[model samples]
Target: MPNLTITEMNNLKEELKKKGYKLTPQRRAIVDTIIENEGKHLTVEEIYDEVKKDCPEIGLATVYRTILLLEELQIVYKLDLNDGCSRYEMVHKDEIHRHHHLICTKCGSVIEVEGDLLENLEVKIEKQYNFKIKDHSVKFFGICQNCGE
Candidate 1:
């Protein structure tokens, strides 16, 4: 699992600072939670649950704000599949696992897949469509084994 230590947390803050973002406590907690729960595409409520452990006073609105900021920074990504709920992933620059999601329709569970596969698809799409792909995301949704009947 991709987890971050206090040092890593501090380093991330420094990196964000370099990117002109001051790391607030709420942002740090959310980012830490994302790293700890890496590969899980967490909804804002789920993130709020994890973040409240460290920042008990933080609110859901703050969670939403922090995630939006992170997404703008390319530090977090969202998967909106024509569904009301949007799931988020942390952008781990050093990890092998990446942002694609395999969502279990019945249980709403999420799995992460390596990104190189999608890179290949992007190449193919660009070749066929001649549309320069700036960035891309992929999601697979189906009944999980537990509910696959």
Candidate 2:
């Protein structure tokens, strides 16, 4: 539901320009597709399929390369569900750390947990180990409500 605002889009364009990367039509289409499917955590193929609807000439390799570039720019990050394929989601500037995920083992549905649920644990670990915690990713796999029902 957190789609990129117009201001965010402009900022992204500026960032790309600063990095000597042009936001070409194909790249824009790829970015728009990702923004439109923000919570879906789409794979490169899925992104290609959706982008193809708007840009029939777009290639799978192009999507793959663009995704890599976006990831490199920290505009997006890959989420591995331990399901073989890699999925991608946007990088929220406001997030101190990546949000957690609730993955349904039975139905394979994914739910995002927006709240940072590991703050206490992080504090304990930092105190115990004398290490600075930058960020973390947590995935809990279990039956979802629908599956439990």
Predicted candidate 1 versus true structure: per-residue lDDT over 1-149, tens digit per residue: 23467786777777788878888767878887887876666789999998898789999999998888888877887878546888887776674445566778888776666655767777889999999877666679887777786
What tens digits encode model 2's per-residue C-alpha lDDT throughout 109-128?
99999889999999999999
Clashing residue pairs in candidate 1 (N, C-alpha, C atoms within 3 angstroms): none
Score each candidate by Cα lDDT.
0.77, 0.91
Q: What's model 2's overall lDDT? A: 0.91
Error of 2 at 132 (Å): 1.4
Worst 10 residues of 2 by lDDT: 1-10
- Indicate which candidate wins on lDDT: 2
* TM-scores for candidates 1 onward, in order: 0.75, 0.93
